[model samples]
Target: MRTSIVFLSALATSVMGANSTTYTLPAGFNVGLVDSSERSAWCSAQRNTCPDICQDGTRLNSCDSNTLDFSCVCADGSTPDVTPFKQTVPFFVCQANYGQCINSHPDDAEGQRTCKKNAVCGSKNATEEADSSSSSTTTAASTTLAMATSTDSTASQTSSVAAASATTSNPAVALGGDMTKYSTGFMAGLMFVAARMIL
Candidate 1:
């Protein structure tokens, strides 16, 4: 009986040790979309464009302390402002996706060739030139301004400046995320281990 008890204890300890081994997942192990408001989270939704910015496990290059968003800082000798949003431009000026430059026209200039090929030139001021068709453009411009200044009076001005700067830097960064993704990796892993034990 003494020998049998010792054997059972040893076996239990061995089994417990095996189960206690921690799995060291790679950096950024989680795969999911990051909310713009999540300061330390990686925005995996824009993977193709910002792959290095977010590692497979959700490891981010750097966190934008100001905005509380994760940013992929360029590697050594690499430039971070590859996107057009990095380029500084006017805050009131309307722009397209990624500084593509949406050429807004006054109702009077319809069909008028104001922009060069691939170049967009729009009204200097949206409210002044907007009509039925241009209503959306006007709304977008206004929304951009409003969002940039949604904070308190003092911070509102500063936020507007940052929003404008982001637009000039990379439209993707400024456009933000439209969808959300979540990862069940940890749960799945736990289930797998539980099944193994039961079997």
Candidate 2:
């Protein structure tokens, strides 16, 4: 019984850890907790396409039209002083489902403008950029150290460092834009397997 309890505890910890990725709001946006009525109105203004609009891997809640819970929205309905622009602009809207900014351009060919995942809207300071660079470098150094001890390990570490550098340079991979669905499915499968083993 004790052994089973320990195994179940470890399994639960792993399951939770697998799904623990938190979404960070990109720069130039401030999130506000809005009531359901405001969220509904905002979603309606988008023709009830919140799910499609907020699919940029930043949504903290489910993309349902009828949900009554408080959801993230743009603070005061606009992101002011975005980078390269000195004035308050009204063309951007907070995705009703997520708090990220959507650049709604009427003149665009598609009639809608969607920013990339983890995109920075406003100006990023030099400090922030430097920190991000240093963090990536530190991560690569640590990974290389842990993977290398001898000549064979050096080869593997070199490849690993190359892969890490590539991922860091690529915006999509660094932000995990394409891994959300796969990670969710993987977590579900893990849970199922854990349940079977526990039973």
Candidate 3:
């Protein structure tokens, strides 16, 4: 009985060692000429680590094998749709069912006008005209100049501008002009002639 037990132990060890050999699989794991589609999965307790599964070319795909097969996992961003196609021509699904209305020319549309009722929509040619118009409008709407508690910056700015304009308009201050300096020189030359005549 001890001899038979030792023989069985050696036989089991030899079988395990033989199954440990490296397996070389073909491309896409296909073993051709053998109908893998018809072959039933030889599942066992040891098949918990089975390498491959056979797939079908039908609506229902191949089955997966795990240690304890629980539930199927749906693919990413995909749920099983009962209505795969609207009418088999494939219309858009989950579309927005509301109408949208937006005025392309928003500035002139929706009860708004480009310009006021009588005013023309145009551009000003001159900056001075625009400034004068704006200033006149402000002056017409007020009765008195508002008293300034702060320093008068605009007054100083106007004075500087007046001084610049006066300098440019009166460029012949010390050099004299045709009216005053020329007349004074003529009077002096006439006096010199008179003095020479007296001598």
Candidate 4:
């Protein structure tokens, strides 16, 4: 009976650990729709493009024929971003094609050509852009705080900044909170069943 208890405890620990495993996307990559067209074309583009983009490992998430939606991401299991369809594509040709698809005047050949050309030329490093934007925001906030001389205000600002930084640095905290709750309940139920069987 004691040995059974020990074995069950070990099994539960392993299972819980497995449940906690989370993957984050590498820098400059995002989970987004590669294309939206016919089922065959969408699926083909997703399957072909994701591997080329995320050579480490690729996860072709979903392809909806009716909705004409298809999405893919790295195998690391990053959460899908809001407005992912509008996010920049890593490849120049894909970006240009996406621009063409979103063109206001789809039937106009000249407009389509201009849109494609602009997209290819305007493609920028997303990671660098994000870093610069965040840094600038932080600097601006710091400048505002510096103008305030109150001790209580400074303390409040410091705490708020710390909390914001914590959440941003560890995205899994928000994502895994629910998973942890579910896993705890599941493990408790399993142990209860095992104890009853052993008794």
Candidate 5:
């Protein structure tokens, strides 16, 4: 049993070096692959430690294994269908979901336009004339600052992110972002394993 924990821990540590994100899905656990609304009710019952920052939309939120599963809810607690006049931007998910609105020409090249120069729905939002790219910059910076200021101790948590995002030569610590949730997921996965062993 001790050997099993060591092996599993080593395997988990190794897998964390990949450069992408992933959660440890135990056998028979649902992955929430479908639309957020259609996700398992039990999963939806799971709570995300972080508040949803979606400006205004029926959002698809995922939780670590410790919680039930995933969730879909309006960011502003409004009817999901009463959207904020959002459009699916062609390529970037961020731009598609979070682009601002403007009243100027669609191709206005000034630094004070709505969405970034890279967004497809660059001319949407609420106001027809008062769009500002500066808003997006401020929003992005605020989000970064929020993540940086999140309350989590590195010493108390473990991460698989380091394995998935960095090279094996140097395992990087999870600096910010979803590391808190990932750590919760990892701990939950470990608990699940231990429970199975006891059973």
Candidate 6:
């Protein structure tokens, strides 16, 4: 449970970033669609052409956080290539399905090219509305859960930022279950705050 709180905090932190599409990821996980432009651009510079494909559950060498250069990254925080890859790999921006899909326009700036990120809890229409209608049998708990979600979304939605939160009874479980989502470490950070509130 404590570990879940930490993850929530991390999610919150990721959501704090402006313009990022944040979402509720499972415990110990946070996915976000951030502007990987620098990394993407660097790859383009190296390959001299933007990649047109990216498969979900696959890591593409694109940005280096430490150096602000391209590096390999995955949803689970894997960075196989700390530096740019000697060879180009599959790279695509986050699409609407929330899974890494074929880039319709890989060269476009963040949020310009639209695609579905699979079931991201915070995506434009993927959000769940926790309310009195829930059948969880914990009325107060449900309301608290709803409030936490509302708070995060209300705070981040203006910029269309995807934020994630959970209810008191189950901090380890992500509040929304219907969508795949992505974002920076911000969503976890926001969720941490929410979890702390529950504690």
Using TM-score, rank the candidates from best to worst.
4, 5, 1, 2, 6, 3
Please list the C-alpha lDDT of all candidates, in the order they appear: 0.36, 0.42, 0.32, 0.49, 0.37, 0.38
- lDDT per residue as tens, model 1, 1-199: 9999999999976854443312222232222322344322222222223333211222223333223233333333232331322111111011221122222333434323433233332223222222443677788999988876774666967776776655444523433642123236744554465455434
lDDT of 2 by residue, 110-147 (tens): 43334444333333343344457778999999888776
TM-score (C-alpha) between model 2 and the true structure: 0.18
Residue 56, model 3: Cα distance from true site in angstroms:
14
> Which model scores highest in TM-score?
4
- Cand. 5 Cα-lDDT: 0.37
TM-scores for the candidates: 0.19, 0.18, 0.15, 0.25, 0.19, 0.16
Q: Write down the lDDT that model 6 would get.
A: 0.38
For residue 1, what is the lDDT in candidate 3? 100
**Between prediction 2 and prediction 5, which has the larger TM-score?**
5
Model 1 spans with C-alpha error above 4 angstroms: 1-47, 52-70, 75-78, 84-106, 110-199
Better of 3 and 5 by TM-score: 5
Return whichever of 2 and 3 wins on TM-score.
2
